[model samples]
Target: MEITILVFGQIKEITGIAAWQISGIKSTEELAAKLVMQFPELALMKYAMAVNKILIQTDTELNENDTVALLPPFSGG
Candidate 1:
Protein backbone atom coordinates (compact mmCIF):
# COMPACT_ATOMS: atom_id res chain seq x y z
CA MET A 1 0.00 0.00 0.00
CA GLU A 2 1.01 3.63 -0.51
CA ILE A 3 0.78 6.38 2.05
CA THR A 4 1.89 9.98 2.41
CA ILE A 5 4.18 10.68 5.37
CA LEU A 6 4.51 14.22 6.65
CA VAL A 7 7.59 14.87 8.77
CA PHE A 8 7.76 17.71 11.24
CA GLY A 9 10.40 19.69 13.16
CA GLN A 10 13.46 17.57 13.91
CA ILE A 11 11.99 14.73 11.89
CA LYS A 12 12.14 16.86 8.76
CA GLU A 13 15.70 17.82 9.56
CA ILE A 14 16.66 14.21 10.11
CA THR A 15 14.94 12.98 6.96
CA GLY A 16 15.73 16.14 4.98
CA ILE A 17 12.18 16.21 3.66
CA ALA A 18 8.90 17.48 5.01
CA ALA A 19 6.72 15.01 3.15
CA TRP A 20 7.08 11.85 1.12
CA GLN A 21 5.48 8.57 0.11
CA ILE A 22 5.90 5.21 1.80
CA SER A 23 5.10 1.75 0.55
CA GLY A 24 5.02 -1.74 2.05
CA ILE A 25 3.36 -0.39 5.15
CA LYS A 26 1.11 -3.18 6.28
CA SER A 27 -0.05 -1.55 9.50
CA THR A 28 0.31 1.69 11.44
CA GLU A 29 2.52 -0.02 14.04
CA GLU A 30 4.74 -1.39 11.33
CA LEU A 31 5.00 2.05 9.88
CA ALA A 32 6.04 3.55 13.18
CA ALA A 33 8.45 0.72 13.87
CA LYS A 34 10.06 1.02 10.47
CA LEU A 35 10.35 4.75 10.88
CA VAL A 36 12.08 4.36 14.22
CA MET A 37 14.38 1.74 12.77
CA GLN A 38 15.21 3.84 9.71
CA PHE A 39 15.66 6.94 11.82
CA PRO A 40 16.89 5.73 15.16
CA GLU A 41 17.14 9.26 16.45
CA LEU A 42 13.40 9.57 16.16
CA ALA A 43 13.08 7.08 19.00
CA LEU A 44 14.18 9.83 21.35
CA MET A 45 11.39 12.14 20.42
CA LYS A 46 7.68 12.18 21.15
CA TYR A 47 5.46 11.68 18.12
CA ALA A 48 1.96 10.89 17.00
CA MET A 49 0.25 9.50 13.92
CA ALA A 50 -2.82 10.83 12.20
CA VAL A 51 -4.75 9.24 9.39
CA ASN A 52 -6.26 11.83 7.10
CA LYS A 53 -6.17 14.33 9.96
CA ILE A 54 -7.72 11.94 12.45
CA LEU A 55 -5.44 10.89 15.27
CA ILE A 56 -5.11 7.19 15.76
CA GLN A 57 -3.00 4.69 17.72
CA THR A 58 0.03 2.96 16.30
CA ASP A 59 -1.87 -0.29 16.20
CA THR A 60 -4.46 1.23 13.91
CA GLU A 61 -4.71 -0.47 10.57
CA LEU A 62 -3.50 1.55 7.63
CA ASN A 63 -5.40 1.96 4.40
CA GLU A 64 -4.09 2.49 0.91
CA ASN A 65 -3.49 6.11 -0.09
CA ASP A 66 -3.89 7.20 3.50
CA THR A 67 -2.21 10.46 4.44
CA VAL A 68 -0.30 9.71 7.63
CA ALA A 69 1.33 12.61 9.33
CA LEU A 70 4.26 12.10 11.72
CA LEU A 71 3.85 14.88 14.20
CA PRO A 72 6.60 15.49 16.72
CA PRO A 73 5.77 17.25 19.92
CA PHE A 74 5.43 21.02 19.59
CA SER A 75 6.71 23.50 22.15
CA GLY A 76 5.87 26.86 20.69
CA GLY A 77 3.54 29.10 22.66
Candidate 2:
Protein backbone atom coordinates (compact mmCIF):
# COMPACT_ATOMS: atom_id res chain seq x y z
CA MET A 1 0.00 0.00 0.00
CA GLU A 2 1.11 3.51 -0.73
CA ILE A 3 0.18 6.67 1.10
CA THR A 4 0.78 10.35 0.46
CA ILE A 5 2.74 12.26 3.05
CA LEU A 6 2.55 16.04 2.96
CA VAL A 7 5.35 17.89 4.66
CA PHE A 8 5.45 21.46 5.86
CA GLY A 9 8.02 24.01 7.03
CA GLN A 10 11.41 22.64 7.95
CA ILE A 11 10.19 19.17 7.21
CA LYS A 12 9.85 20.11 3.54
CA GLU A 13 13.27 21.67 3.60
CA ILE A 14 14.84 18.55 5.05
CA THR A 15 12.83 16.13 2.95
CA GLY A 16 13.06 18.36 -0.12
CA ILE A 17 9.41 18.11 -1.11
CA ALA A 18 5.97 19.07 -0.01
CA ALA A 19 4.46 15.70 -0.90
CA TRP A 20 5.66 12.23 -1.63
CA GLN A 21 4.67 8.58 -1.66
CA ILE A 22 5.85 6.05 0.84
CA SER A 23 5.17 2.52 2.00
CA GLY A 24 1.88 1.79 3.64
CA ILE A 25 1.30 2.72 7.21
CA LYS A 26 1.16 0.13 9.95
CA SER A 27 0.47 2.59 12.76
CA THR A 28 0.59 6.33 13.08
CA GLU A 29 3.45 6.16 15.53
CA GLU A 30 5.35 3.84 13.25
CA LEU A 31 4.74 6.26 10.43
CA ALA A 32 6.44 9.02 12.36
CA ALA A 33 9.26 6.75 13.32
CA LYS A 34 9.80 5.66 9.75
CA LEU A 35 9.84 9.26 8.56
CA VAL A 36 12.36 10.19 11.20
CA MET A 37 14.51 7.31 10.06
CA GLN A 38 14.27 8.33 6.44
CA PHE A 39 14.93 11.96 7.27
CA PRO A 40 17.07 12.10 10.36
CA GLU A 41 16.48 15.82 10.72
CA LEU A 42 12.84 15.24 11.53
CA ALA A 43 13.80 13.64 14.82
CA LEU A 44 15.07 16.98 16.05
CA MET A 45 11.90 18.95 15.48
CA LYS A 46 8.43 19.12 16.95
CA TYR A 47 5.91 17.60 14.57
CA ALA A 48 2.40 16.26 14.42
CA MET A 49 0.32 14.34 11.93
CA ALA A 50 -3.22 14.37 10.72
CA VAL A 51 -5.07 11.71 8.81
CA ASN A 52 -7.59 12.94 6.27
CA LYS A 53 -7.63 16.28 8.01
CA ILE A 54 -8.55 14.64 11.30
CA LEU A 55 -6.12 14.94 14.18
CA ILE A 56 -5.29 11.44 15.29
CA GLN A 57 -3.23 9.69 17.90
CA THR A 58 -0.22 7.56 17.08
CA ASP A 59 -2.37 4.42 17.10
CA THR A 60 -4.70 5.70 14.45
CA GLU A 61 -5.30 3.25 11.66
CA LEU A 62 -4.38 4.42 8.17
CA ASN A 63 -6.13 3.46 4.97
CA GLU A 64 -4.70 2.87 1.52
CA ASN A 65 -5.61 6.34 0.31
CA ASP A 66 -5.18 8.15 3.55
CA THR A 67 -3.69 11.61 3.32
CA VAL A 68 -1.22 12.19 6.08
CA ALA A 69 0.08 15.65 6.75
CA LEU A 70 3.34 16.13 8.66
CA LEU A 71 3.33 19.51 10.29
CA PRO A 72 6.14 21.16 12.19
CA PRO A 73 5.34 23.37 15.12
CA PHE A 74 3.85 26.69 14.06
CA SER A 75 4.55 30.00 15.69
CA GLY A 76 2.07 32.77 15.09
CA GLY A 77 0.08 34.20 17.95
Candidate 3:
Protein backbone atom coordinates (compact mmCIF):
# COMPACT_ATOMS: atom_id res chain seq x y z
CA MET A 1 0.00 0.00 0.00
CA GLU A 2 3.05 2.20 -0.04
CA ILE A 3 4.35 3.92 -3.15
CA THR A 4 7.53 5.80 -3.88
CA ILE A 5 7.19 8.88 -6.10
CA LEU A 6 9.91 10.38 -8.25
CA VAL A 7 9.59 13.86 -9.72
CA PHE A 8 11.67 15.22 -12.57
CA GLY A 9 12.14 18.45 -14.56
CA GLN A 10 9.46 21.02 -13.93
CA ILE A 11 7.54 18.56 -11.84
CA LYS A 12 10.40 18.46 -9.38
CA GLU A 13 10.44 22.21 -9.19
CA ILE A 14 6.75 22.23 -8.34
CA THR A 15 7.04 19.64 -5.64
CA GLY A 16 10.33 21.07 -4.42
CA ILE A 17 11.69 17.58 -3.89
CA ALA A 18 12.92 14.88 -6.18
CA ALA A 19 11.45 11.95 -4.29
CA TRP A 20 8.96 11.10 -1.62
CA GLN A 21 6.81 8.30 -0.25
CA ILE A 22 3.04 7.94 -0.11
CA SER A 23 0.63 5.32 1.12
CA GLY A 24 -2.97 4.16 0.67
CA ILE A 25 -2.94 5.11 -2.98
CA LYS A 26 -4.47 2.29 -5.03
CA SER A 27 -3.95 3.31 -8.66
CA THR A 28 -2.27 5.81 -10.91
CA GLU A 29 -5.50 7.76 -11.23
CA GLU A 30 -5.79 8.09 -7.50
CA LEU A 31 -2.16 9.04 -7.27
CA ALA A 32 -2.71 11.85 -9.73
CA ALA A 33 -5.60 13.20 -7.71
CA LYS A 34 -3.60 13.03 -4.52
CA LEU A 35 -0.65 14.77 -6.13
CA VAL A 36 -2.79 17.56 -7.44
CA MET A 37 -4.28 17.97 -4.03
CA GLN A 38 -0.84 18.20 -2.46
CA PHE A 39 0.62 20.33 -5.22
CA PRO A 40 -2.06 22.37 -6.87
CA GLU A 41 0.37 23.73 -9.45
CA LEU A 42 0.62 20.25 -10.90
CA ALA A 43 -2.97 20.52 -12.08
CA LEU A 44 -1.90 23.27 -14.45
CA MET A 45 1.05 21.42 -15.92
CA LYS A 46 1.22 18.59 -18.40
CA TYR A 47 3.22 15.51 -17.56
CA ALA A 48 3.59 11.81 -18.13
CA MET A 49 3.65 9.05 -15.59
CA ALA A 50 5.66 5.87 -15.36
CA VAL A 51 5.20 2.99 -13.06
CA ASN A 52 8.31 1.12 -12.11
CA LYS A 53 10.08 2.63 -15.11
CA ILE A 54 7.37 1.81 -17.66
CA LEU A 55 5.47 4.70 -19.22
CA ILE A 56 1.74 4.31 -18.73
CA GLN A 57 -0.88 5.40 -21.19
CA THR A 58 -3.78 4.65 -18.89
CA ASP A 59 -4.59 4.28 -15.28
CA THR A 60 -2.41 1.54 -13.86
CA GLU A 61 -2.62 -0.44 -10.67
CA LEU A 62 0.04 0.20 -8.07
CA ASN A 63 1.64 -2.08 -5.51
CA GLU A 64 3.55 -1.76 -2.32
CA ASN A 65 7.00 -0.30 -2.81
CA ASP A 66 6.20 0.48 -6.45
CA THR A 67 8.06 3.45 -7.87
CA VAL A 68 6.02 6.08 -9.71
CA ALA A 69 7.70 8.82 -11.66
CA LEU A 70 6.26 12.18 -12.76
CA LEU A 71 7.95 13.38 -15.92
CA PRO A 72 7.34 16.82 -17.34
CA PRO A 73 7.48 17.56 -21.04
CA PHE A 74 11.03 17.89 -22.29
CA SER A 75 12.88 18.59 -25.49
CA GLY A 76 16.27 17.36 -26.58
CA GLY A 77 18.58 18.42 -29.34
Candidate 4:
Protein backbone atom coordinates (compact mmCIF):
# COMPACT_ATOMS: atom_id res chain seq x y z
CA MET A 1 0.00 0.00 0.00
CA GLU A 2 1.58 3.21 -1.12
CA ILE A 3 0.49 6.59 0.29
CA THR A 4 1.36 10.02 -0.95
CA ILE A 5 2.27 12.53 1.77
CA LEU A 6 1.89 16.25 1.28
CA VAL A 7 3.27 18.71 3.81
CA PHE A 8 2.20 22.33 4.14
CA GLY A 9 3.45 25.40 6.04
CA GLN A 10 5.75 24.66 8.93
CA ILE A 11 5.18 20.96 8.57
CA LYS A 12 6.96 21.08 5.25
CA GLU A 13 9.90 22.80 6.89
CA ILE A 14 10.09 20.07 9.47
CA THR A 15 10.06 17.29 6.93
CA GLY A 16 12.18 19.32 4.50
CA ILE A 17 10.05 18.18 1.62
CA ALA A 18 6.72 19.33 0.22
CA ALA A 19 5.70 15.85 -0.84
CA TRP A 20 6.82 12.27 -0.74
CA GLN A 21 5.62 8.71 -0.86
CA ILE A 22 5.62 5.97 1.74
CA SER A 23 4.50 2.37 1.73
CA GLY A 24 3.41 -0.42 4.06
CA ILE A 25 1.49 1.95 6.30
CA LYS A 26 -1.97 0.58 7.04
CA SER A 27 -3.78 3.45 8.75
CA THR A 28 -3.53 7.11 9.71
CA GLU A 29 -2.35 6.15 13.20
CA GLU A 30 0.44 4.04 11.81
CA LEU A 31 1.39 6.79 9.41
CA ALA A 32 1.62 9.32 12.23
CA ALA A 33 3.78 7.03 14.31
CA LYS A 34 6.03 6.28 11.40
CA LEU A 35 6.41 9.95 10.54
CA VAL A 36 7.21 10.90 14.12
CA MET A 37 9.78 8.14 14.21
CA GLN A 38 11.38 9.38 11.02
CA PHE A 39 11.11 13.08 11.86
CA PRO A 40 11.33 13.50 15.60
CA GLU A 41 10.66 17.21 15.33
CA LEU A 42 7.14 16.50 14.19
CA ALA A 43 6.36 14.97 17.56
CA LEU A 44 6.49 18.43 19.10
CA MET A 45 4.31 20.22 16.60
CA LYS A 46 0.53 20.44 16.27
CA TYR A 47 -0.96 19.66 12.89
CA ALA A 48 -4.07 18.50 11.11
CA MET A 49 -4.30 15.62 8.65
CA ALA A 50 -6.39 15.19 5.57
CA VAL A 51 -6.95 12.05 3.62
CA ASN A 52 -7.73 12.76 -0.01
CA LYS A 53 -8.37 16.41 0.90
CA ILE A 54 -10.82 15.73 3.72
CA LEU A 55 -9.74 16.89 7.17
CA ILE A 56 -9.78 14.07 9.69
CA GLN A 57 -10.41 14.49 13.38
CA THR A 58 -9.54 10.93 14.25
CA ASP A 59 -7.54 8.03 12.98
CA THR A 60 -8.84 6.95 9.60
CA GLU A 61 -8.22 3.97 7.39
CA LEU A 62 -5.93 4.53 4.45
CA ASN A 63 -5.90 2.90 1.04
CA GLU A 64 -3.47 2.44 -1.80
CA ASN A 65 -2.67 5.58 -3.78
CA ASP A 66 -4.36 7.76 -1.15
CA THR A 67 -3.04 11.27 -0.70
CA VAL A 68 -2.43 12.31 2.91
CA ALA A 69 -1.77 15.93 3.67
CA LEU A 70 -0.15 17.36 6.79
CA LEU A 71 -1.32 20.87 7.58
CA PRO A 72 0.03 22.98 10.35
CA PRO A 73 -1.91 25.62 12.21
CA PHE A 74 -2.41 28.81 10.24
CA SER A 75 -3.07 32.39 11.18
CA GLY A 76 -4.29 35.22 9.01
CA GLY A 77 -5.99 38.56 9.35
- lDDT agreement with native, every candidate: 0.85, 0.84, 0.94, 0.94
Cα lDDT tens digits, model 2, 1-77, are: 77889989888999998998877576788888898899898889887789988777657877788889988887888
Write candidate 1's Cα lDDT for 1-77 as tens digits.
Answer: 79999988878888788999989897888988898898888888787778889988648888899988888888889
Each prediction's TM-score versus the true structure: 0.88, 0.86, 0.94, 0.94
Better candidate number, 1 or 2, judged by TM-score:
1
Residue-level lDDT tens digits of model 3 in 1-77: 78999999999988999999999999999999999999999999999899999999999999999999989888877
**RMSD in order of candidates:** 1.3, 1.5, 1.1, 1.0
Error of 2 at 15 (Å): 0.5
Provide the lowest-lDDT 10-residue window in model 1: 54-63
After superposition on all CA atoms, how large is the RMSD of candidate 1?
1.3
- Give per-residue lDDT, candidate 4, residue 64: 96
Q: Candidate 4: misplaced stretches above 4 Å?
A: none
Predicted candidate 4 versus true structure: per-residue lDDT over 17-60, tens digit per residue: 99999999989999999999999999998998999999999999
Model 4 accuracy (lDDT, Cα): 0.94
Candidate 2 vs 3: which has more lDDT = 3
The TM-score-based order of candidates, best leading, equals 4, 3, 1, 2
